[model samples]
Target: MFDIKSFFKREVEKKLIDVDDYIFMPERVEMELEGGLLNCVLNSDGRVDIFYSKEGVTEVSSASRKHPFTSFETELNHGVYDDVIDDLIKEVSKIIDGSSKYFRRNKVLPSTAALPSKPPTDL
Candidate 1:
């Protein structure tokens, strides 16, 4: 007799494992761009933090003490992690590349007021 319940359970477990490996396990990823370093960090609560820092600076101090040039936070879902991350990178890249002046004009910083009023749903 086929065990449907067991099969479904295994499938779900495998999906979770894949999500963990693809998203959570990395913890932090960095990319160096023309303007500075772009940092992405995954928090346990499903929030991803993307920030920018100047080149050659100590990541720890910049991340801890100074306000990031720009910061984006979004919840990562199993199937949408890749899109979410890519979108964030594009947004930050625009800012760093000087193609977008919206952030610069407003001087948005990492603060309660600067946070997105509602979680983004476009992903």
Candidate 2:
């Protein structure tokens, strides 16, 4: 059986993060076949924002905004469902890579629901 919880745990283990790390989001977040609403969540100590509708969770394509992944997106380099939680880890890695500036300047540290909370300092 495809257990979301177990799969998530496995992914975290694969990523080699502390259990206290920020809980970013879900595995197959925003599965288009499943209406792409993205079963999203945030820090381990925060609340999830569930977007619902009368019908149910709906598909959410990338809004036409200046997304962080502009390079990948503009070039159509990203695979499908690449913006959802676990999938977006690469985006987080990018931030971590350039932590010094964007992380604090943009004020995007891991929030409460963030799993395996991010380190206060990345040095």
Candidate 2, residues 12-95, lDDT tens digits: the string is: 676654433344332122223222333432223323332312123232223222222233223223543234433344333444
Q: Model 2: residues >4 Å from true position, as ranges?
A: 1-38, 41-87, 101-123
| Worst 10 contiguous positions by lDDT, candidate 1 | 61-70
lDDT of residue 72 for candidate 1: 28
Best by TM-score: 1
Q: What is candidate 2's TM-score against the reference?
A: 0.17
Kindly list the per-residue Cα lDDT of model 1 for residues 1-123, writing each as its tens digit.
999999999998776644334323336766765456766675544345666555333222112201112222322223234454455456655545564545565676765657887999999
TM-score of each: 0.31, 0.17
Residues forming the 10-long window of minimal summed lDDT in candidate 2: 60-69
Where in model 1 is the C-alpha error above 4 Å?
A: 1-26, 53-86, 89-123
